[model samples]
Target: MKERIMSKDLMNKIDALGAQEYMSDAQLAVFEEHLRGEHERLIVRQQEITNTSMKNPESISGDEADKANAIQSSADARAESEKNKAMLRSVSVALQAIKTRDYGYCIKCGEEIGLKRMISQPAACRDIECETLEERKNKQNPAANLKIS
Candidate 1:
């Protein structure tokens, strides 16, 4: 996903608000809007992928190469759908956090996620430090990060 660019006006507002008042109403609105947009986009893309895959039925009477290609295509679509679903869940959680007035704090450390980080990645639930540490841990032990679902 591309990082959202903060407008100069929003940046100025954030600068004026300071750390103690992080995720001011304006900031939350911005992040909420971005997250909602991403959620809608992912839903549309997932639907498109599903529709396309459905339209391309696997051919049972084709050559072995054609069968293989169809299977690979189906697998690719499934993977992409799964990825979109995961993103949708993240976006939904972020939206819920916004509604609960708990949007900007890091889930792991309880620190402000910072205006710049929230603007750039609206669905983020962790501050950079905690997120970095989690990523490192996941890299070292990938199985620990796997979701059974």
Candidate 2:
């Protein structure tokens, strides 16, 4: 049947993508391992931030300037943690896409994402054109940062 043939073709495509020579499977594996380690590190860092409250305004019991600096530093750390969390979410989505045979395809336009881009960014969900548009939109309106994958 046509459906059966299409399914087999899809399987073949997936197999080809997974092949070691052309797709940078080994590099992706290394990048994934590095990402996992970074995720763990960020979790530990977040925990440390949560545990450290002496710098908070309520607990500072110190000079006003020092308290202000502490608050600013704490805020910066929280922002960094949030960025890390976002990146982790992107990585998680990329991993799931790989498992679902949806990797290497632009989530937005469905074009084949370049292998070089994929190697450079194992979590990429968009080709350059789509990604550029998304970035421009996000820069213009932060709230419009649509989840790609």
Candidate 3:
């Protein structure tokens, strides 16, 4: 995945909004544009992964090592696709929140998620404290966050 590098001017603008206020119209516009760009980029990347996976066939008449490598590569591609899908979902949710005027607030605690955090991770749905607690809980009981078919 390509790393997102926030420009210094953008960071300064976000920082100037202060930590107390909810995202203003300008802030929301910035985030909305960013999320939209990410959504498109992820869609394109997913298509590329799907196309590549379709073009690459598993070795049917190769040495055991070659077969294993092919299997591993396929698995890796699948994992990456799944990750991209999850990110797309997150971006979608963030966009929806922006439309609802609930962006930059923690879903779990109903507190401002802070401009710094939002600027760094626009898809964040929780504040740092709540997020840390949730992460700890997930770590303590990983299976609780998983679904089985």
Once superposed on the true structure, which residue ranges of model 3 sit more than 4 Å away at CA?
1-4, 7-21, 55-59
Give the per-residue lDDT of model 3 (tens digit) for 1-149.
Answer: 23445544457766666663468787898789878988999999999999877745454467988877777878889999999999999999999999999999999999999877887787999999999999999999999988687
Query: What pairs collide in candidate 2?
Result: none
Per-residue lDDT of model 2, residues 1-149, tens digit only: 74355335444444555646433555455545544655676677667766763355557767989878888888887777677678778877877776676777899999988765665565789999999998898899986665666
**Each candidate: how many clashes?**
0, 0, 0
Tens digit per residue, CA lDDT, model 1, 1-149:
13324344445655655664567787677667767777888999999999978845365567988888888888899899988898899999999999999898899989998877776667889999999999999999998967887
Report how far residue 61 has shifted in candidate 3, in Å: 3.3
Please give each candidate's TM-score: 0.80, 0.67, 0.86
User: Would you list the clashing residue pairs of candidate 3?
Assistant: none
Q: Which model is ahead, 1 or 2, in terms of lDDT? A: 1
lDDT of 2: 0.68
Q: Which candidate order results from sorting by TM-score in descending order?
A: 3, 1, 2
**Candidate 2 — worst ten consecutive residues by lDDT sum?**
2-11
Best by lDDT: 3
Clashes of 2: 0
